[model samples]
Target: MNKVYHLSSCNTCQKILKELNLPASFETQDIKEEEITKEQLEEMEALAGSYEALFSRRARLYRERELNKKELSEADYKELILDHYTFLKRPVILNNDEIFIGNSKKTVAAAKAAVHG
Candidate 1:
């Protein structure tokens, strides 16, 4: 499966998608428009190892809700991500069995290579 889960309004995601230049075979899912389901998140977690790996602590809601002050568990991470779309990191790309999560330089580079190569 060649799928990219991203937020349409995020600049980083837009830039990455533009850089990737994916073909028609690639599928794009706008998380804001279509919220991620539990099954989808579970699939991602299965490839990513854990929900924590897929969760983004940099979201504005995280700080606004003071989630940083509290200790979060695996379940909390999953719940937060499911409840709010922003809790997820931008641009989660799934290329076959390889899953890339986040917008870091290295992650984006690797994702691009996977799709382009």
Candidate 2:
């Protein structure tokens, strides 16, 4: 399955999608419009190895709510992500069994290469 989970309003996400130049068959899921289900999160975790890997500490809520002060467990991460879509890192690309999470230069480059090559 070739899918990209991203926020529609994010400029970075849009830029990455353009850069990816994915085929017409590629599926795009706007996380803001459709919240990610627990089952989907589990599937991502399975490929990503851990929920923490998919979690985004950069979320404004994380800092505003002082979530950084507390120690969050695996379950906490899952719950937070489920409760708020912003808790997830943007532009998560799932290409077959390989998963790429985040907008870092290396991750984006790797994802582009995987889809193009």
Best-performing candidate as measured by lDDT = 2
lDDT (10s digit) by residue, model 1, range 1-117: 889999999998999999889878889999999999999999999999999999999999999999999999999999999999999988899999999999889998998898888
lDDT for predicted candidate 2 compared with the true structure: 0.94
Q: Assess every candidate by TM-score.
A: 0.97, 0.98
List the pairs of residues colliding in candidate 2: none
| Model 2 bad stretches (over 4 Å) | none
Instruction: Return the lDDT, model 1, position 29.
Output: 98
lDDT of 2 by residue, 1-117 (tens): 889999999999999999999988789999999999999999999999999999999999999989999999999999999999999998899998899999999999999999988
Which candidate ranks first by TM-score, i.e. highest?
2
